[model samples]
Target: MMGSVAQLWRHPIKSHGREALEAVTLSVGQCMPLDRHWAVTHEASRFDGTGWVSCQNFMIGARTPGLAGLWARVDEEARRVTLTHRDLGELTFAPDDPAEAARFLDWIAPLCPENRARPSAVVSVQGRGMTDSDFPSISVMNLSSHRAVAQKLGRDIEPERWRGNIWLDGLGPWEEFEWIGKTIRIGSASLHVRKRITRCLHTAANPITGKRDTATLDALEVGWGHCDFGVYCEVIDGGDIRLGDKSEVL
Candidate 1:
Protein backbone atom coordinates (compact mmCIF):
# COMPACT_ATOMS: atom_id res chain seq x y z
CA MET A 1 0.00 0.00 0.00
CA MET A 2 1.47 3.27 -1.05
CA GLY A 3 -1.11 5.31 0.76
CA SER A 4 -4.77 5.70 1.74
CA VAL A 5 -7.42 7.96 0.36
CA ALA A 6 -7.40 11.11 2.42
CA GLN A 7 -9.96 13.19 0.52
CA LEU A 8 -12.19 13.23 -2.54
CA TRP A 9 -13.42 16.26 -4.48
CA ARG A 10 -15.42 16.98 -7.58
CA HIS A 11 -16.03 20.13 -9.54
CA PRO A 12 -19.51 19.85 -11.03
CA ILE A 13 -19.17 23.10 -12.93
CA LYS A 14 -15.71 23.43 -14.43
CA SER A 15 -13.62 26.17 -12.77
CA HIS A 16 -16.66 27.37 -10.84
CA GLY A 17 -16.53 25.56 -7.52
CA ARG A 18 -15.44 22.36 -5.80
CA GLU A 19 -17.46 19.92 -3.70
CA ALA A 20 -16.19 17.26 -1.32
CA LEU A 21 -17.28 13.65 -1.59
CA GLU A 22 -16.98 10.85 0.93
CA ALA A 23 -17.36 8.04 -1.60
CA VAL A 24 -18.05 7.75 -5.30
CA THR A 25 -18.55 5.10 -7.95
CA LEU A 26 -16.09 5.21 -10.79
CA SER A 27 -16.88 4.16 -14.34
CA VAL A 28 -14.39 2.79 -16.77
CA GLY A 29 -13.24 5.30 -19.42
CA GLN A 30 -15.00 8.14 -17.63
CA CYS A 31 -14.10 10.98 -15.28
CA MET A 32 -15.15 10.97 -11.63
CA PRO A 33 -18.95 11.23 -11.34
CA LEU A 34 -20.17 14.69 -12.29
CA ASP A 35 -16.72 16.16 -12.22
CA ARG A 36 -16.59 19.06 -14.68
CA HIS A 37 -20.00 17.99 -15.88
CA TRP A 38 -20.88 21.59 -16.73
CA ALA A 39 -18.84 24.55 -17.90
CA VAL A 40 -19.72 28.18 -18.35
CA THR A 41 -18.71 29.48 -21.72
CA HIS A 42 -17.96 33.13 -22.44
CA GLU A 43 -19.62 35.29 -25.09
CA ALA A 44 -16.56 34.97 -27.29
CA SER A 45 -16.50 31.19 -26.96
CA ARG A 46 -16.89 29.20 -30.12
CA PHE A 47 -17.72 26.04 -28.22
CA ASP A 48 -20.73 24.69 -30.09
CA GLY A 49 -21.08 21.84 -27.59
CA THR A 50 -20.33 19.44 -30.47
CA GLY A 51 -17.29 18.15 -28.59
CA TRP A 52 -14.69 18.99 -25.95
CA VAL A 53 -13.22 22.46 -26.21
CA SER A 54 -10.20 24.19 -24.75
CA CYS A 55 -10.30 25.81 -21.29
CA GLN A 56 -9.69 29.24 -22.77
CA ASN A 57 -13.26 29.31 -24.07
CA PHE A 58 -14.65 29.34 -20.58
CA MET A 59 -14.45 31.51 -17.46
CA ILE A 60 -11.75 30.00 -15.27
CA GLY A 61 -9.76 30.77 -12.16
CA ALA A 62 -6.61 31.33 -14.17
CA ARG A 63 -8.30 34.26 -15.84
CA THR A 64 -10.76 35.19 -13.10
CA PRO A 65 -9.06 34.70 -9.77
CA GLY A 66 -12.21 35.48 -7.74
CA LEU A 67 -13.75 32.21 -8.86
CA ALA A 68 -11.30 30.25 -6.72
CA GLY A 69 -13.19 31.18 -3.55
CA LEU A 70 -16.42 29.52 -4.62
CA TRP A 71 -17.43 26.27 -2.92
CA ALA A 72 -20.25 23.95 -3.94
CA ARG A 73 -22.54 21.21 -2.70
CA VAL A 74 -24.18 18.96 -5.28
CA ASP A 75 -27.26 16.82 -5.01
CA GLU A 76 -26.48 14.27 -7.65
CA GLU A 77 -29.92 12.65 -7.75
CA ALA A 78 -31.61 16.01 -8.16
CA ARG A 79 -29.02 17.20 -10.67
CA ARG A 80 -28.77 20.41 -8.69
CA VAL A 81 -25.87 22.34 -7.20
CA THR A 82 -25.69 24.92 -4.43
CA LEU A 83 -22.77 27.29 -4.63
CA THR A 84 -21.45 29.62 -1.94
CA HIS A 85 -18.82 32.30 -1.89
CA ARG A 86 -17.76 34.98 0.56
CA ASP A 87 -19.05 37.69 -1.72
CA LEU A 88 -22.12 35.81 -2.90
CA GLY A 89 -23.86 34.03 -0.08
CA GLU A 90 -25.52 31.01 -1.72
CA LEU A 91 -27.53 29.91 -4.70
CA THR A 92 -29.19 26.58 -5.47
CA PHE A 93 -30.08 25.89 -9.06
CA ALA A 94 -30.28 23.27 -11.73
CA PRO A 95 -27.40 24.00 -14.06
CA ASP A 96 -29.13 22.37 -17.01
CA ASP A 97 -32.18 24.60 -16.80
CA PRO A 98 -31.83 27.49 -19.18
CA ALA A 99 -33.67 29.96 -16.98
CA GLU A 100 -31.66 29.07 -13.90
CA ALA A 101 -28.41 29.10 -15.83
CA ALA A 102 -29.11 32.65 -16.94
CA ARG A 103 -29.64 33.58 -13.33
CA PHE A 104 -26.36 31.94 -12.46
CA LEU A 105 -24.55 34.04 -15.01
CA ASP A 106 -26.06 37.17 -13.54
CA TRP A 107 -25.11 36.12 -10.02
CA ILE A 108 -21.54 35.34 -10.97
CA ALA A 109 -21.04 38.44 -13.09
CA PRO A 110 -19.58 40.49 -10.30
CA LEU A 111 -16.76 38.05 -9.71
CA CYS A 112 -15.63 38.22 -13.33
CA PRO A 113 -13.72 41.10 -14.82
CA GLU A 114 -15.36 43.54 -17.27
CA ASN A 115 -12.46 43.40 -19.71
CA ARG A 116 -12.68 39.62 -20.08
CA ALA A 117 -15.31 37.95 -22.16
CA ARG A 118 -18.63 37.78 -20.34
CA PRO A 119 -19.93 34.40 -19.22
CA SER A 120 -22.81 33.61 -21.56
CA ALA A 121 -24.11 30.10 -21.15
CA VAL A 122 -23.85 26.85 -19.25
CA VAL A 123 -22.93 23.90 -21.46
CA SER A 124 -22.13 20.22 -21.23
CA VAL A 125 -20.99 17.48 -23.56
CA GLN A 126 -22.93 14.25 -23.23
CA GLY A 127 -21.00 11.33 -21.68
CA ARG A 128 -17.86 13.42 -21.27
CA GLY A 129 -16.36 15.86 -18.81
CA MET A 130 -14.79 19.16 -19.77
CA THR A 131 -11.45 18.30 -18.21
CA ASP A 132 -8.23 20.11 -18.99
CA SER A 133 -6.89 16.97 -20.66
CA ASP A 134 -8.36 15.95 -23.99
CA PHE A 135 -9.11 12.49 -22.60
CA PRO A 136 -11.24 11.76 -19.57
CA SER A 137 -8.99 11.80 -16.51
CA ILE A 138 -9.09 11.77 -12.74
CA SER A 139 -6.46 13.71 -10.84
CA VAL A 140 -4.66 12.12 -7.90
CA MET A 141 -2.61 14.21 -5.50
CA ASN A 142 -0.26 13.17 -2.71
CA LEU A 143 -0.48 14.82 0.69
CA SER A 144 3.21 14.30 1.32
CA SER A 145 4.05 16.16 -1.86
CA HIS A 146 1.80 19.04 -0.78
CA ARG A 147 3.55 19.13 2.57
CA ALA A 148 6.93 19.27 0.90
CA VAL A 149 5.80 22.26 -1.17
CA ALA A 150 4.48 23.92 1.94
CA GLN A 151 7.76 23.30 3.68
CA LYS A 152 9.61 24.87 0.80
CA LEU A 153 7.36 27.93 0.96
CA GLY A 154 7.61 28.03 4.75
CA ARG A 155 3.83 28.16 5.17
CA ASP A 156 0.80 25.96 5.14
CA ILE A 157 -0.94 25.47 1.82
CA GLU A 158 -4.49 24.31 1.35
CA PRO A 159 -5.11 21.23 -0.79
CA GLU A 160 -8.08 22.96 -2.46
CA ARG A 161 -5.63 25.04 -4.50
CA TRP A 162 -4.76 21.97 -6.56
CA ARG A 163 -8.41 21.18 -7.44
CA GLY A 164 -7.62 17.45 -7.54
CA ASN A 165 -10.17 14.63 -7.55
CA ILE A 166 -8.48 12.33 -5.06
CA TRP A 167 -5.86 12.98 -2.40
CA LEU A 168 -3.71 10.27 -0.84
CA ASP A 169 -1.60 10.26 2.29
CA GLY A 170 1.46 8.25 3.44
CA LEU A 171 3.53 8.48 0.24
CA GLY A 172 6.91 10.15 0.13
CA PRO A 173 7.34 13.55 -1.46
CA TRP A 174 7.20 13.38 -5.25
CA GLU A 175 6.66 9.60 -5.09
CA GLU A 176 3.58 9.65 -7.33
CA PHE A 177 5.59 10.88 -10.31
CA GLU A 178 7.28 7.44 -10.37
CA TRP A 179 3.91 5.79 -10.97
CA ILE A 180 3.51 7.17 -14.46
CA GLY A 181 2.42 4.50 -16.96
CA LYS A 182 1.66 2.18 -14.04
CA THR A 183 -1.60 0.74 -12.73
CA ILE A 184 -2.84 1.64 -9.28
CA ARG A 185 -5.77 0.30 -7.27
CA ILE A 186 -7.88 2.34 -4.92
CA GLY A 187 -10.71 0.54 -3.20
CA SER A 188 -12.06 -1.75 -5.93
CA ALA A 189 -11.12 0.45 -8.88
CA SER A 190 -8.01 0.21 -11.00
CA LEU A 191 -6.60 3.21 -12.83
CA HIS A 192 -3.74 3.60 -15.28
CA VAL A 193 -1.60 6.60 -14.45
CA ARG A 194 -1.23 8.56 -17.63
CA LYS A 195 0.89 11.69 -17.13
CA ARG A 196 1.87 14.53 -14.88
CA ILE A 197 -0.63 17.38 -14.36
CA THR A 198 1.19 20.58 -15.21
CA ARG A 199 -0.39 23.34 -13.16
CA CYS A 200 -1.32 26.88 -14.18
CA LEU A 201 -1.74 30.32 -12.67
CA HIS A 202 -5.08 29.22 -11.16
CA THR A 203 -3.17 27.35 -8.47
CA ALA A 204 -1.59 30.57 -7.28
CA ALA A 205 -5.02 31.82 -6.17
CA ASN A 206 -6.02 31.05 -2.62
CA PRO A 207 -9.24 29.09 -2.45
CA ILE A 208 -10.40 30.78 0.74
CA THR A 209 -9.80 34.34 -0.22
CA GLY A 210 -9.88 33.99 -4.00
CA LYS A 211 -6.73 36.13 -4.16
CA ARG A 212 -3.35 35.53 -5.70
CA ASP A 213 -1.50 35.26 -2.44
CA THR A 214 1.13 32.65 -3.24
CA ALA A 215 3.59 32.09 -6.01
CA THR A 216 2.80 28.37 -6.38
CA LEU A 217 4.22 28.13 -9.88
CA ASP A 218 7.41 29.81 -8.77
CA ALA A 219 7.69 27.64 -5.68
CA LEU A 220 7.37 24.44 -7.72
CA GLU A 221 9.87 25.67 -10.27
CA VAL A 222 12.43 26.63 -7.64
CA GLY A 223 11.92 23.58 -5.42
CA TRP A 224 11.43 20.90 -8.08
CA GLY A 225 12.20 22.60 -11.39
CA HIS A 226 8.69 21.75 -12.62
CA CYS A 227 5.15 23.02 -12.19
CA ASP A 228 3.49 19.63 -11.84
CA PHE A 229 1.78 18.79 -8.58
CA GLY A 230 -0.39 15.79 -9.40
CA VAL A 231 -0.90 12.90 -11.80
CA TYR A 232 -3.82 12.19 -14.16
CA CYS A 233 -5.21 8.66 -14.37
CA GLU A 234 -7.73 6.81 -16.49
CA VAL A 235 -9.94 4.21 -14.91
CA ILE A 236 -9.35 0.80 -16.48
CA ASP A 237 -11.60 -1.07 -14.04
CA GLY A 238 -14.57 0.53 -12.36
CA GLY A 239 -15.79 0.27 -8.80
CA ASP A 240 -16.48 2.25 -5.68
CA ILE A 241 -13.75 4.49 -4.24
CA ARG A 242 -14.18 5.87 -0.76
CA LEU A 243 -12.34 7.83 1.82
CA GLY A 244 -9.86 5.74 3.81
CA ASP A 245 -9.59 3.14 1.02
CA LYS A 246 -6.16 1.69 0.50
CA SER A 247 -4.23 2.81 -2.59
CA GLU A 248 -1.73 0.31 -3.95
CA VAL A 249 0.41 0.18 -7.06
CA LEU A 250 -0.44 -2.95 -8.96
Candidate 2:
Protein backbone atom coordinates (compact mmCIF):
# COMPACT_ATOMS: atom_id res chain seq x y z
CA MET A 1 0.00 0.00 0.00
CA MET A 2 1.18 3.50 -0.78
CA GLY A 3 1.47 5.89 2.13
CA SER A 4 0.74 9.59 1.91
CA VAL A 5 2.22 12.44 3.89
CA ALA A 6 0.12 13.36 6.91
CA GLN A 7 2.29 15.87 8.79
CA LEU A 8 5.74 17.43 8.86
CA TRP A 9 7.56 18.84 11.89
CA ARG A 10 10.82 20.62 12.56
CA HIS A 11 12.50 21.24 15.89
CA PRO A 12 14.60 24.37 15.49
CA ILE A 13 15.75 24.02 19.07
CA LYS A 14 16.50 20.49 20.13
CA SER A 15 14.28 19.06 22.88
CA HIS A 16 12.69 22.38 23.79
CA GLY A 17 9.78 22.53 21.30
CA ARG A 18 8.38 21.73 17.88
CA GLU A 19 7.12 23.62 14.81
CA ALA A 20 4.77 22.33 12.16
CA LEU A 21 5.20 23.03 8.48
CA GLU A 22 2.69 22.54 5.67
CA ALA A 23 5.46 21.91 3.12
CA VAL A 24 9.24 21.54 3.08
CA THR A 25 12.05 21.36 0.58
CA LEU A 26 14.32 18.37 1.12
CA SER A 27 17.87 18.55 -0.12
CA VAL A 28 20.30 15.76 -0.94
CA GLY A 29 22.69 14.86 1.89
CA GLN A 30 20.77 16.94 4.42
CA CYS A 31 17.90 16.63 6.84
CA MET A 32 14.80 18.86 6.72
CA PRO A 33 16.21 22.36 6.35
CA LEU A 34 16.36 24.39 9.59
CA ASP A 35 15.49 21.27 11.58
CA ARG A 36 17.63 20.93 14.70
CA HIS A 37 19.34 24.07 13.55
CA TRP A 38 20.17 24.97 17.13
CA ALA A 39 20.60 23.12 20.41
CA VAL A 40 20.80 24.13 24.03
CA THR A 41 24.19 23.27 25.47
CA HIS A 42 24.49 22.58 29.17
CA GLU A 43 27.24 23.88 31.49
CA ALA A 44 28.70 20.37 31.64
CA SER A 45 28.62 19.83 27.86
CA ARG A 46 31.83 19.66 25.84
CA PHE A 47 30.20 20.23 22.49
CA ASP A 48 32.15 23.04 20.78
CA GLY A 49 30.04 23.42 17.67
CA THR A 50 32.83 21.70 15.72
CA GLY A 51 31.04 18.46 14.78
CA TRP A 52 28.16 16.30 15.85
CA VAL A 53 28.38 15.38 19.52
CA SER A 54 26.49 12.78 21.49
CA CYS A 55 22.96 13.88 22.42
CA GLN A 56 24.01 13.70 26.05
CA ASN A 57 26.01 16.84 25.47
CA PHE A 58 22.83 18.82 25.01
CA MET A 59 19.59 19.43 26.91
CA ILE A 60 17.11 16.80 25.72
CA GLY A 61 13.61 15.61 26.50
CA ALA A 62 14.93 12.23 27.63
CA ARG A 63 16.58 13.96 30.56
CA THR A 64 13.88 16.54 31.25
CA PRO A 65 10.52 15.45 29.89
CA GLY A 66 8.98 18.82 30.77
CA LEU A 67 10.80 20.37 27.86
CA ALA A 68 8.17 18.83 25.63
CA GLY A 69 5.60 21.29 26.91
CA LEU A 70 7.49 24.10 25.25
CA TRP A 71 6.46 25.18 21.74
CA ALA A 72 8.56 27.09 19.24
CA ARG A 73 8.15 29.11 16.07
CA VAL A 74 11.09 29.73 13.78
CA ASP A 75 11.37 32.67 11.45
CA GLU A 76 14.09 31.45 9.13
CA GLU A 77 14.21 34.64 7.20
CA ALA A 78 14.93 36.62 10.34
CA ARG A 79 16.94 33.89 12.11
CA ARG A 80 14.73 34.23 15.16
CA VAL A 81 12.98 31.74 17.41
CA THR A 82 9.86 32.33 19.46
CA LEU A 83 9.39 29.98 22.39
CA THR A 84 6.10 29.56 24.22
CA HIS A 85 5.01 27.55 27.21
CA ARG A 86 1.95 27.49 29.41
CA ASP A 87 3.89 28.87 32.34
CA LEU A 88 6.53 30.98 30.62
CA GLY A 89 4.27 32.67 28.10
CA GLU A 90 6.46 33.63 25.09
CA LEU A 91 10.10 34.55 24.43
CA THR A 92 11.48 35.74 21.11
CA PHE A 93 15.13 36.12 20.18
CA ALA A 94 17.94 35.16 17.89
CA PRO A 95 19.48 31.95 19.21
CA ASP A 96 23.05 32.83 18.38
CA ASP A 97 23.01 36.00 20.45
CA PRO A 98 24.63 35.60 23.83
CA ALA A 99 22.12 37.91 25.48
CA GLU A 100 19.22 36.01 23.97
CA ALA A 101 20.73 32.72 25.00
CA ALA A 102 21.11 34.01 28.52
CA ARG A 103 17.48 35.09 28.53
CA PHE A 104 16.41 31.66 27.31
CA LEU A 105 18.41 30.03 30.06
CA ASP A 106 16.65 32.19 32.67
CA TRP A 107 13.21 31.35 31.33
CA ILE A 108 13.90 27.62 31.60
CA ALA A 109 15.79 27.49 34.91
CA PRO A 110 12.79 26.41 36.95
CA LEU A 111 11.85 23.78 34.39
CA CYS A 112 15.26 22.12 34.54
CA PRO A 113 15.31 18.95 36.57
CA GLU A 114 17.48 19.06 39.66
CA ASN A 115 19.40 15.90 38.73
CA ARG A 116 20.51 17.28 35.37
CA ALA A 117 23.14 19.89 34.71
CA ARG A 118 22.37 23.56 34.06
CA PRO A 119 21.85 25.00 30.61
CA SER A 120 24.59 27.38 29.40
CA ALA A 121 23.69 28.66 25.97
CA VAL A 122 22.08 27.94 22.65
CA VAL A 123 24.48 27.10 19.84
CA SER A 124 24.50 25.82 16.26
CA VAL A 125 26.59 24.42 13.42
CA GLN A 126 26.27 25.68 9.90
CA GLY A 127 24.84 23.37 7.23
CA ARG A 128 24.27 20.44 9.57
CA GLY A 129 21.19 19.28 11.45
CA MET A 130 21.86 17.96 14.95
CA THR A 131 20.29 14.57 14.39
CA ASP A 132 20.41 11.37 16.42
CA SER A 133 22.20 9.67 13.55
CA ASP A 134 25.71 10.76 12.66
CA PHE A 135 24.58 11.01 9.08
CA PRO A 136 21.86 13.49 8.24
CA SER A 137 18.44 11.84 8.51
CA ILE A 138 14.78 12.51 7.92
CA SER A 139 12.50 10.49 10.21
CA VAL A 140 9.37 8.92 8.70
CA MET A 141 6.61 7.52 10.89
CA ASN A 142 3.44 5.68 9.92
CA LEU A 143 0.20 6.93 11.40
CA SER A 144 -1.09 3.38 11.48
CA SER A 145 1.90 2.39 13.57
CA HIS A 146 1.06 5.18 15.97
CA ARG A 147 -2.46 3.78 16.18
CA ALA A 148 -1.09 0.33 16.94
CA VAL A 149 1.05 1.76 19.71
CA ALA A 150 -1.94 3.66 21.05
CA GLN A 151 -3.91 0.44 21.07
CA LYS A 152 -1.14 -1.25 23.02
CA LEU A 153 -1.23 1.53 25.58
CA GLY A 154 -5.04 1.44 25.66
CA ARG A 155 -5.23 5.16 24.89
CA ASP A 156 -4.43 7.82 22.36
CA ILE A 157 -0.71 8.48 21.77
CA GLU A 158 0.16 11.95 20.60
CA PRO A 159 2.25 12.00 17.41
CA GLU A 160 4.43 14.79 18.88
CA ARG A 161 6.17 12.22 21.07
CA TRP A 162 7.93 10.77 18.05
CA ARG A 163 9.44 14.15 17.03
CA GLY A 164 9.55 12.94 13.45
CA ASN A 165 10.48 15.02 10.43
CA ILE A 166 7.69 13.56 8.34
CA TRP A 167 4.62 11.48 9.17
CA LEU A 168 2.76 9.26 6.69
CA ASP A 169 -0.56 7.41 6.62
CA GLY A 170 -2.06 4.22 5.12
CA LEU A 171 0.81 1.82 5.99
CA GLY A 172 0.66 -1.06 8.41
CA PRO A 173 2.18 -0.83 11.86
CA TRP A 174 5.98 -0.73 11.67
CA GLU A 175 5.87 -1.57 7.96
CA GLU A 176 8.35 1.17 7.12
CA PHE A 177 11.10 -1.02 8.55
CA GLU A 178 10.59 -3.40 5.63
CA TRP A 179 11.76 -0.69 3.26
CA ILE A 180 15.26 -0.48 4.75
CA GLY A 181 18.00 -0.52 2.11
CA LYS A 182 15.33 0.37 -0.46
CA THR A 183 14.29 3.61 -2.11
CA ILE A 184 11.05 5.45 -1.54
CA ARG A 185 9.48 8.27 -3.50
CA ILE A 186 7.61 11.11 -1.81
CA GLY A 187 6.25 13.77 -4.07
CA SER A 188 9.22 14.78 -6.26
CA ALA A 189 11.84 13.74 -3.71
CA SER A 190 13.37 10.31 -3.06
CA LEU A 191 14.72 8.82 0.12
CA HIS A 192 16.75 5.73 1.00
CA VAL A 193 15.53 4.10 4.17
CA ARG A 194 18.51 3.20 6.30
CA LYS A 195 17.75 2.63 9.97
CA ARG A 196 14.94 2.10 12.44
CA ILE A 197 14.54 4.82 15.04
CA THR A 198 14.96 3.45 18.54
CA ARG A 199 12.36 4.60 21.03
CA CYS A 200 13.48 6.66 24.00
CA LEU A 201 12.28 8.21 27.24
CA HIS A 202 11.45 11.29 25.21
CA THR A 203 8.40 9.44 23.96
CA ALA A 204 7.14 9.17 27.52
CA ALA A 205 6.78 12.94 27.79
CA ASN A 206 3.41 14.53 27.15
CA PRO A 207 3.58 17.30 24.54
CA ILE A 208 0.93 19.31 26.33
CA THR A 209 1.91 18.91 29.97
CA GLY A 210 5.52 17.85 29.45
CA LYS A 211 5.11 15.22 32.11
CA ARG A 212 6.09 11.56 32.02
CA ASP A 213 2.48 10.49 32.08
CA THR A 214 2.64 7.68 29.51
CA ALA A 215 4.33 4.30 29.60
CA THR A 216 5.38 4.33 25.97
CA LEU A 217 8.62 2.45 26.42
CA ASP A 218 6.98 -0.13 28.66
CA ALA A 219 4.17 -0.64 26.18
CA LEU A 220 6.53 -1.03 23.24
CA GLU A 221 8.74 -3.40 25.16
CA VAL A 222 5.82 -5.54 26.26
CA GLY A 223 3.96 -5.52 22.94
CA TRP A 224 6.83 -5.62 20.42
CA GLY A 225 9.72 -6.80 22.64
CA HIS A 226 11.76 -3.88 21.31
CA CYS A 227 11.58 -0.12 21.42
CA ASP A 228 11.41 1.04 17.82
CA PHE A 229 8.83 3.27 16.15
CA GLY A 230 10.07 4.97 12.99
CA VAL A 231 12.51 4.81 10.08
CA TYR A 232 15.42 7.10 9.22
CA CYS A 233 16.14 7.85 5.61
CA GLU A 234 18.74 9.83 3.71
CA VAL A 235 17.51 12.13 1.02
CA ILE A 236 18.75 10.82 -2.32
CA ASP A 237 16.88 13.18 -4.61
CA GLY A 238 15.96 16.67 -3.51
CA GLY A 239 12.68 18.45 -4.12
CA ASP A 240 9.52 19.69 -2.47
CA ILE A 241 7.50 17.32 -0.29
CA ARG A 242 4.26 18.73 1.04
CA LEU A 243 1.53 17.61 3.33
CA GLY A 244 -0.81 15.13 1.56
CA ASP A 245 1.94 14.27 -0.93
CA LYS A 246 2.16 10.68 -2.18
CA SER A 247 4.69 8.27 -0.67
CA GLU A 248 5.50 4.96 -2.37
CA VAL A 249 8.11 2.33 -1.60
CA LEU A 250 10.23 1.76 -4.70
In candidate 2, residue 106 scores what lDDT?
93
* Clashes by residue pair, model 2: none
* Per-residue lDDT of candidate 2, residues 89-169 (tens digit): 899988888988898899988889988898988888878888888888899999998999999999997999999999999
Model 1 per-residue lDDT tens digits across residues 90-208: 99999999999999999999999889999999999999899999999999999999999999999998999999999999998999999999999999999999999999999999998
Instruction: Please give the TM-score that candidate 2 achieves against the real structure.
Output: 0.98
| Alpha-carbon local distance difference test for all models | 0.95, 0.91
Residue 237, model 2, lDDT: 97
Scanning candidate 1 in windows of ten residues, the lowest lDDT window is 1-10
CA displacement after TM-score superposition, residue 141 of candidate 1 (Å): 0.3
TM-score for each model = 0.99, 0.98
